[model samples]
Target: MHFCTKFLIVITAFCSYSMELKQPIVSYILNKINNSEEGTNSRADPLSKNVEGLEKLLSETEALNQTEKIYTVEHLVKSNGYPIETHYVTTGDGYILRVHRIPSSPKMNASNGKVAFLQHGILCSAADWVITGSEKGLGFLLADAGYDVWMGNARGNTWSRNHTTLNPDKDAKFWKFSFHEIGLYDIPAMIDYALEKTGASSVYYVGHSQGTTAYYVMLSELPAYNSKIKMAANLAPIAFLNHMSPLFQIMSLFEPMGNFLANLIGINEFMPTSNFFKYLIGNKICAEDSVTEYLCTNALFAFCGFDYAQLNKTLLLFIIKYTPAGGSTRQFFHYGQAIHSDKTNILSDLD
Candidate 1:
């Protein structure tokens, strides 16, 4: 399929799906996020004043929704009434990554159809594509639209935390990869696996944030893979660090120092958890009607341009629940290097 055509199909599906929702609720949420611009100010600490009350309210609300929590990608897909298949792809570096597939949906006859590979961003997992629920998420939407949808989980994430030889928990070598290894091994492994399973010559590639970064690297360094991809759709692509989020700007300044600290502390893995993540960011910042809701939401939009109208406050918890699914410290350090050097290529220590 043509790139523009595929994009339009996805957009049209999203619009049609959106129109089917209870507009009153959607409209109210949109209006609140849009009109309350003053609440999203970055200068103020959103959680500083009412910390105790916020924590209490969030705890109570979480207790109420305890039965509804979806943790793994398999649980997420099956809960949404979709048939999902789990495939394991072993990277060249021996890391075993999990890929999720939604072969068909009720809305379309997807047998023998074009395959669409969805890759998540940094510190994310396959669950990121489906966290927004069945009606809104791209994974479900693509499946319903008749595309054979496959979501990739990069190595070192929640889903891809295993290796053929080394144990992730004890082996320091397992965490020795940047996105460079992800591009060279993970992407190709998933691509080959998906194409072989579906008997397809080429597949459409859709990447977001760091997903796009790896795609660019793969196409640039190993051009042979170009023949295997039909079209590449990059969302919020991050090739240049000239313009960065304030949070990242501050982190960039401490890249070298942070790397030193990581080595000193012997911390290899970054924030990868279910319970802690839910309690921290999900409950504390995004629980329903929390005082600091705007702060957390705004930080996200500030880093990746705010689209108030599209901001659904209700889904914030789901977003938090699935994101920061964990990655190597080196992956983040690699981006930090890019930020300091202002170059896209991987930097050596001597550089």
Candidate 2:
């Protein structure tokens, strides 16, 4: 090819790329607007800029939800559902996620607005709240304390594995949801259901790990749900990605590889070595027999016969059943920045 022709081709490509970038913004203002200049909650646009490092955290959160679980475990225990794993099929172009409701021991009055909704971390199921015989888990404790507690297993988790409109195993649309989508879509649905079931106007929210991240998305993307949230308690929450668990660091490198693996396995959230990965992750959490008993036991915090090793085993089994086959690569990176900063203030975006 002539040198001049080659140069012309390169110039054309560069110009085309620049134009493509500008087109979206121009289209948004001219075509995407509804004469309000308010593009889908302009209030959320700045996303509470004054809240410390939230703006930077949320911009990346939506991306991190796509990343996969780096570590895994081997379940020494087994998978046991309280009432049973329930599926809510929404007619959408994404995976059909599952939800699990943890059963509370007999006495639960909800304590008025004190009912709590427990959202598990990534690769976790509702069982995370009650792995062992101990009832001291946050979910169990809430229930024992006279608060109605309902644990949730999001769409990809083993429990919420069916969809009304998407096939995660075969359809490209099945993997369309990111953690952000959970906040924007699932939380509201869950909240509405919880409210109806409990006959309460509002309920306390307890989110651990990715569970908390999803709440941030809901709080940021759809501010309306914020009003429904009575009080939100974040346990080991990763609002600001800076101070995340060591387990999450590896996700940054693994994020790009997901697409290939999904294509290879014909899925998005499944861990190649799930059994092995579960044990690896189970070790990081509280696993001491004494700790599990004291921590997971009811309000009394009595010994519940759960050994540290058993806890690890239980935790592993829980992970295998819950972690979805496909994680959102884009959402994972979005949250990575927040993990790096370690700022819970990013949580204020929900306010």
* TM-scores for all predictions: 0.77, 0.55
Residue lDDT tens for model 2, 155-197: 6665565677666566655555557667767776777777877
Score candidate 2 by TM-score against the native: 0.55
Candidate lDDT values, in order: 0.75, 0.50
Best by lDDT: 1
Q: Which residue ranges in model 1 land beyond 4 Å of their true spot?
A: 1-69, 110-112, 298-308, 344-351
